[model samples]
Target: MGIFLPNLLVIGGVLILPWVLMLFNYAWWRPKRLERALKKQGIHGPPYKLLSGNIIDEFRALKASHAKPMGLSHHILPRVAPFHLQTVKNYGKTSVTWFGTDPRVNIMDPELIREVLSNKFGHFTKPPPTSLLKQLVTGLVTHEGKKWAKHRRIINPAFHVEKLKRMLPAFSTSCNELVSKWEQWVGSEESRELDVWPDLQALTADVISRAGFGSSYKEGKRIFQLLTEQSELIMQAVQTAFIPGYEFLPTKGNLRRREIVREVKAILKSMIEKREKAMKTGEADNDDLLGLLMESNFKESQEQGNSNSMNIEDVIEECRLFYFAGQETTSSLLTWTMIVLSMHPSWQVQAREEVLQVFGENKPDIDGLSHLKIVTMILYEVLRLYPPAIFLTRCTYKRMQLGGINLPVGVQLALPVLLIHHDPELWGEDADEFKPERFSGGVSKATKNQVSFFPFGWGPRICIGQNFAMIESKLALAMILQRFSFELSPSYVHAPYTVVTLRPEYGAQLILHKL
Candidate 1:
């Protein structure tokens, strides 16, 4: 019996040794197979490291480079690495880089971006593994396949032109409040150097609350604060999560992120539950985004006879997305526009003149806003310069051909929207310079009849709220221009970075002059 026991132990050890070694090789020693594949195809980038790939080294280089004083152009590079922007520039427009174990990167070619965004459900889909972000917000933005189709179908009506027209009143009210506040600051004083960043943030939050939730700014403001806090923590996690085992450690930032997520979810839940109850009792008001979405979703669910059409949880997720996406995009657009206008007072004067011509001394209505062509051009130019969402990403589910390259499955594509928007080849030699007149004849003419301008994205999955955002932005711009002339304050630091969206790292400060 003793001899048999010894033999059994020996056999078990012998069998387990090879498996353990194989696991180790898979985790650490194996060369990044994707990097090798790219090299073999005559594509090359900075050499990859073992398991961590180029993340740590690339980030170090990026941080060092960014530490120096740089113009608006340098902000386009990787402020933190996987030096994606530099890598793409070095390895041609369509190139790949390693994000830890993941093989992903910039597909700067306009055609490829079009293919990925337009041909949804073909070779790519929204990557399913979104870490903890999916738990916080998973509405139309993250959904795919049949789920996306259904959500898109139900949510479409809420953002239709007529629907947006109804929400214009909400937009005007928010803009009025903002103008009133700014007026107070400019009372009897020729000018006041105000940080328009916070004001824009508050204004957008108010718009989303009144336009999206049918609730007052007070409720929406609370949600916006929580969302902003949550986004900051998430951005930090994304920066460090590329390192191995970083997420598992209960760091201060991670704990705070979890808390923020919890608070946001709780707030969303209470609002949704209350709205749902009110809806059931026929006391729901369709004044804001929440009410409209709920009312639309409930009716659709009943009509479809599917219990899953638009549940309370789904409605809450949509609301969360609205708060984050809607508010952030508009705020970024307005802030950058203000800065650019300040830089070129000529354009600012032109835009303000156009606004005054359209709606002098009275609130601009939706119809009046549509005719403000110069304002639209300036906004489009601002969007080109500092697109709110810097990049869009997709994961390949099957081996597919993109721009004549045979892309293998599991390869992730990072389509840098800002890079594409700012590409000299696409937008001409003066791409980096701010010139609103380039868009005088609309986007098609702006790009010399190319399909390169996609601020809200492209194809089937383009932002559903794009029209709503545009109208809201135009209205807000007109209102601000009508009341005040502003310029970047001397103390303002022009540090633009991506934190879920392209944001001025230091808040955009400007001196507001009462017109």
Candidate 2:
């Protein structure tokens, strides 16, 4: 018996040794293999380093470029670290870079991007494992396959034209409050140069709270604050995600992110629970997004004959997503639109004129917003110049052919929307310039018969809230124009950087003048 026991122990040790080595190889050696494969395909960039890869180099470049002031020329692109515009320029349109062990294929071709986003299920899908940040607010944005289809189908009605019309009152109420607040501030003898970014962010948050959640802004404000903090931490994590187990460490940023996530989830849970209780008691009379979602989800549950339809947790995640996705995109749209209008006062005047011509001094209705052609054109132009999401990423789970290249499983692709939007080949030499006239006739005419512009992305998975965002933006812009005229303040800096969305690093400071 003793001899048999010794033999068993020896065999177990031998088996475990290989498994440990294999784990080590997967964590440390696989990335090198990917880098070699990319190199063999004639793809090149900064050479990959151990673990950190090119992350340090990327950050260094971003820091140096950000230190300099932005130039007026459209050619002077925004500064970003680790992955600068220079790298894109140097590597050609379809270059490959190593994000840790993963080989990221950067595709800037508009036609190819259209193919990928359109046929998402066929060629590729959302990354196999979304990061923790994604897990916190996973809904339509992160869902893929059948789940995504179902969610998309169910949520589509919430943003329908009729539903948006219902939500317009909420939008107007929020915008009116913003206008009234600004008017009060402007009435003082001393002129105030305000950072409209934060104000716009707050207004959008309030609007989403009342319109989407049917809740007060007080709770929504807290969620926004948590989301902003989470955004910063997620950016940092993304920069280092290539490193194995980086998120597990108790670093200051990671710890804070975890705490914020907890806080956000807790708050959302309480709100959802309260709303559910109200619904059960037949006291909830709201027709807002929260109410709509609950009603829709209840119907789905009945059809499936499942008691556990969309539970508190599911509602919480969706609500968190509502605030994060809904608020952020509209806020970005408004901020960049304001900046563009400041740059081209003539276009700004044209948009205001169109707004007045259509709606006069009356609050903008759904029909009136739809008819604001000039304002729509200007907004489209701003989106083209500064899209909210600079790039879209996907990972291949099986061997596939893309752009005639044989791609293996685990290869990541980055569809850089910003580069594609500004590509001379697609939009011509004047592509980089802000010309609202391009979109004067609508997106089809604006592209000059090409499918080049994709600010809200392309194909089946285009942003669900595109119409909602456009309506919200048109309403807010119309209200602002009705009440005030503004220009970029001297202290304003043109530093656009990507945290979650491309945003002015300092703030969008504008000198507001009462009309």
Candidate 3:
């Protein structure tokens, strides 16, 4: 028994001890060391707490900020991200904070942000995705290095301008359905009050489903519905993620999230299999996103060999991305655009006038959309004010020099896009005000070619589907403006928040006057 006990102790020292030491380093020692290093470099923020660090503080701030809705104002950073606002206010723009044991340094400077995002030597990379986040989507958004480049190359063809031109029919069809429903709701009555948030959500989903899967749109819609539920669960998980293995707990929400992921994958697998078989048989029209992706994948396999081609699992993840990112970005943009236009009726009128002058009663074509100067200006302003994504985060894996700061490995650099977009110094004293004219001279003139305004991100990793999103938004907005003159309904509450993307927390209620 004494010999067995000694052997067990030796085994523990050899195996479990290293893991324990590593955990201690990650959860305690490393953070303290990083904190000291940052402080020495003149970067300071909230003091780090053992294990939980600033996560609990962040949660408290978030809960307090979101307890009630704000007034009708464009200055939404405080409500949308209270903790970040407070940290930046306390420690200057490029300051540090903790997300669990990791140090998060907020970089509100546009030029530094450009360097981080551009990632010239690949020092900064996308932060590893959490398990809950993976439930929402993966593929390109989560991948890095060679995998990201490969996937991006394969997916590029699907979003080319010529390809988007082909998908215009899908965009138009989706908008037509929305117009029809709203028309029916306003039926014979001069005006009707309705909450447009869910309707817009549905519209973007429908467009993605149609454009992504073509004949398998019904299946795609089912997958998106599950994805929506999964996203909600993920947000809930985000609040308590400091608890290790929180996602694996046998809780109702976690179980439901698992179920949702399984269902979505199953549906996507069936749809993909059918599409692949049809394509091989030459019975499929390779026009939609999924078909185009497969065609691209096939060509890539032929050119670069099968090893470089995305496998079935990779294809599935990309499809999930197609639905999640494609729908979330455009829906959030359209919803905010509607709410903003409602707030400023003058701009709405001007946008509608521009739309009318460009297309009259005709459906908006791709060329006409480009000429929508006023409408384009409004969309840009909306994106600046209530960007669908509030911030972008990159982590340093190896020691890197960013600006004047020496960022240590394992430190996260947060580009607070919301703050950058609303900086008075950058956008004048009326930065918070709704003014589309700031964009009238075009984005390059507006920021003098700085990466100050990156709603779709910037550089090599900029969203591939940006053109698709803008085209869809322009088409949807033009159609809505042509069919209806809308204003904020009395029931509308100005509660902007984030759940994967920035959104109107209580839905956008507007009175639609049928024109």
Candidate 4:
């Protein structure tokens, strides 16, 4: 018994000692060394606390920001990114904050954001999600390295501009239904007061349903509804993820998120299997996004003889991504466009004139949407002022030099898109104004050669569904302008907050007048 006990003790030390030392290294030594290095380089930020670090502070900041509504102004930096804004304001643009033991540097410089995002050698990649959070999302957005490369290859064809043009009918049909529904609701009143937020959500959801999944909106809307719930739950989990053992607590939010994720996965799997069966029976048109993805995957594998095709789970991940991304980005863009255009009626008038000139009372065609220069400008301006995603983050696994500062491994880079978008230094004197003229020439010309404007994101890893979103937005906006002229309702409260994406905190109620 004594001999066995000694052997057990020896084995325990062999296993536990290295891990304890590694924990000490990770939780103390390395962080301190990195902090001193950063401080020496003049990069300073809020001082960190033990294991909690800045997480509690960050949580408080987010809570305080979202606690009450703000004035309806173009300045959204403070509202959408309270913590980062306060940190930047207090500690300059390039400052550090602790995410647990890891130091996350806030980089407000456009050049630095561009370099990190356009990383060619994979020096920077998105930090892995927490174990619980990973279940909420996956696919290309979460992938890196060669897996990302292959997925991009197989998915590119599905989002090609020409392919998106073919999907215009789906966009128009959903939009037409929304227009008809709104028209019916307005009846004969000079104007109608209605919360268009939910309607817009449904419209975008239906568009994604028909265009993405090759099914009726009624059939696919569950995915949208559940995914929306999932986003909120995901945010809840993100806020509390740093709390060790939080996932095991069986909290209501935790249970709800887990439930929502399961529902989403099951729905996606069933739908994907249905499409796969249809394709095998030669009964599918291969037009919808999912069908096209399958066709593309098959064609690539057959032509190139590559056996490394994405599995069913991988395809489901892509579907989830497409569903969430396709819905969120366009819906946010459209929602903001509606609200902003309502605020500035003159621009709305001009955009309507442009749309009318391009397509009149007819449905907007793919070709004519290209001629919607004014509408395009307005859309770009909204993206600049109220981008759907306010931040982009990248992490390093090796010590490296970036933007004249040396960063150690395990350091995270926080690229605040909204801060850079709203910067006066980069965008000029009227940076806060809602002026579409800045982008009249183009994005490159708008920023005057700075990496300032990337509403859809910048670099090779930029949003692949950008064309689809743009086309969908143009068709919907063209139709909305054709049918109604709207202004902010007296009851409308301008509350824009980020729940995964920038969204109207209060429902967007508008006073709509039939043209």
Candidate 5:
């Protein structure tokens, strides 16, 4: 009996001890070590707590800040990123914070940010998406190394300027539908109080649906509906992300997420298969995004063989990214543009005048859209004030030196776009004010060649669809300016918050006066 018991104990120790040690390292030793490393470099932040780390503190701060809408103000760092702001204020611009034992160094300096994002030496890499995040999004955005290069190569041709020019009709079609719908709602009424937030979302979604899948929003409405639900569920799941294996359990949320992913993939797979068949039979048009991507894929496959190209599933993920990223960027920009323009009537007037002069009550053609410099300036300024993405994150997989600090492996880098945008040092004393003229001379002249104004990110890894987004925003804004003048409604609450992308909490209720 003693012999048997001792053997059982030995087996148990052999099987379980490694996992226990790993847990200890992850929960305690690693965090403490990283903390000491940062402290030694004269960078410090809120002391890390075990397991949950700073997540609980971040949650509490965000919850309290988001309890109610703020007044009409562009100083939204306090409302949107209270914890990060507090951390920076308490520690310094170059500070540290914990996201579940993972030390995230807040690098707000543009020079340092440039180095990290440029990744010239390939020292910094995007933090691997969590399983929950993977469920929500994956594709070129998530990949690294050869796989990323391959996907980017295949995807590049799809977003090239020439291809985007071809997609202009799709953008025009979507914008025309939206403004026409609004004109109908306004009817004979002098002005109409309308919440443009949801409507704008629908507009962008419809745009991506057409441009991406060569179909109307109604044709692929189910995919978007599933994605929206998945996004909400994923946001809730993010709260419990630090709890290891929490998403793997058969919890209701987890199960539903799984179901949503399955359905979404199924729908995309069917669409892709049909498209592939149509292309093979020469019946499909090669103008939309999907056609371009597939054509690019085929070209790559022909040159390097099938092994180098993305599979059907990879194609599906890219389509998903197109919908999410493409839709979110333009919609957020448009929504904020409406709200900000309403707040600053003079700039709105200037923008409308410029739009009127450029297009003169005509449908915005590509040439005229590009010539609307005032509208472009307004969009750039709005992006600076309320960037669709509040922050960009990356991680170190190997020990590396960033500026003067030695970044330990596994250290996460947070480039707080919102803070940098609103910094007095970066943008002057009137940084928070709505001044579109700051961008009148173009992005280069505005920032004096500094890597400061990157609403769509900076460097080679910058968003591929930035041009697509700017063009779409310009066309839509020009159309709206041609038709109606708008101002915030009495019921409108000025609360800009982040939900993947920064959005209005209480909705953008604006009174649209027919011009």
Candidate 6:
């Protein structure tokens, strides 16, 4: 009896005690402490429940909201982010919502949002994705502090304006191919009712292939296709991510995600091997993104005596970043630009006129692209209205006070870019309206030099590929304007939704008039 009792006690201590502690910390103590802290600061959210916290309610709300598309209006906040809109209405901008037990403070104030993103002290860091989701892609976007700085420094040379100018031919080539394909379908004086959405995605993907990997898109087309599938898988995983141990289960989704990531890694590995061999033979000049990155990494390690050069795995991740981020940003920007321009022909005419006057009957060069004032203004306005990334998130690693609210460690801040962009107080009465004139004087002038316009993000860790994406977008728009004038088709449905990035729920169908 004595031996059995001792054995039972040891077993209980080994298993049950930790479970009890986990329950105590994760379920009860954390929620109440966070709630009390926020409440004392006069910031209250919906009541937090144990275990699930606010996740169940949030999921239900999202499911119901996404049941059907909303009306066609510029006030897209309600459609894209119904939960956020409703929460703000109920609990005010500074309320704390629960993503599991972790309190995600809804930071609507632009100043506070800027403070977190700027992260001067590096106390705030990006919340890491789920372990399974990390398999999707982990690049500089997901890095922090020293790692982020190292990666940024190495990758910076690849996207410099001079290097990008070298890539203009690749951009023009892809655009020319897209235009030619459209021309075949569109004889003189005939309009083609086409969905520019998929076509633009293909165009950007092809550009990334040729410019990013120094090969025709056909060689790298598989990468784009796989990445797209992975993105869809990620969106599914994210909905259930808040549930503990959910990803561990070998469900179809989890299996597929694993398989997809494995395949993607294998593909990237093969490409990197070939490129590395070519570089060793002194056959490449680091022109394309992958080559530039490997060269930059090597030069840094050799010249600066820094061993912080990215490994083969890091290079692969960056390539993933280039393919996914590069393609998504430009494609969304181009697709929406077409839709908005179609809606407002005057702006379209003005932009096309600027493109033509700058470079008449000739290809768009870097010089002419730089001088496209009207086109730049139009793109800036579209970014303001429908930023590709709808929100930027950061979490506190140490207890910190922000905008006068004391936040506990592990608390997240949701800086909803779309909400802040559409705020009337910041952008004047016509904030929701499409007014490229608001940016007539540029982004700094638009926000009165405040951090109000951050479609690509702001501060030290702003998106490194912003210039690359912009130049690619400008080239596509310029080429398209030169070739065709398009208007929204009657069959087009206006349904903007977020699938990682804000996209039209229904495809962007437009009638192209060959110009």
TM-score leader? 5
TM-score of 4: 0.94
Candidates in order have lDDT scores of: 0.79, 0.80, 0.91, 0.86, 0.90, 0.86
User: Tens-digit lDDT track for model 3 on 219-323?
Assistant: 877877888888888888876777777778899998998898888888899999999899888899888999999999999999999999999999999999999
- Which is superior by TM-score, 1 or 2? 2
TM-score for candidate 2? 0.93
Per-residue lDDT, model 1, residue 352, is 90
Better of 4 and 5 by TM-score: 5
lDDT of 4 at 220: 79
Tens digit of per-residue lDDT, candidate 4, span 237-289: 77666666788787898888878878888888888888888889998877899
- Estimate, for each residue in 115-177, the C-alpha lDDT of model 6 and write its tens digit: 787864377889986585487678898988788888998999998989888888888899999
TM-score, each model? 0.92, 0.93, 0.97, 0.94, 0.98, 0.96
lDDT of 2: 0.80
lDDT of 2 by residue, 1-515 (tens): 98999999999999999988886676667776776777777767667677666677777778788888885444435564336466777787678766666678887766677667777565778775556656456877777787777777667778788888888888999999999999898886435688999999999999998898776568888998889878877877777786667888999987888788789889887777787799899998557888888778888888875553566666777788889988888899899899878988999899889888998899888888888888988888889888888778888888888777777778889887787788778888998799988886788876765557888877888888888899899999999999889998999888888787888889999989887
Candidate 3 ranges beyond 4 A from true positions: 1-16
Scored against the true structure, residue 6 in model 3 reaches a CA lDDT of 96
Better structure of 2 and 3 per lDDT: 3
What C-alpha lDDT, on a 0 to 100 scale, does residue 466 get in candidate 2?
88
Q: Which 10 residues in a row give candidate 1 its minimum summed lDDT?
A: 73-82
Kindly give the stretch of ten consecutive residues in candidate 6 with the minimal lDDT sum: 112-121
TM-score rank order: 5, 3, 6, 4, 2, 1
Q: Tell me how candidate 1 scores on lDDT.
A: 0.79
What are the root-mean-square deviations of the candidates from the true structure over C-alphas?
2.7, 2.8, 1.6, 2.2, 1.3, 1.9
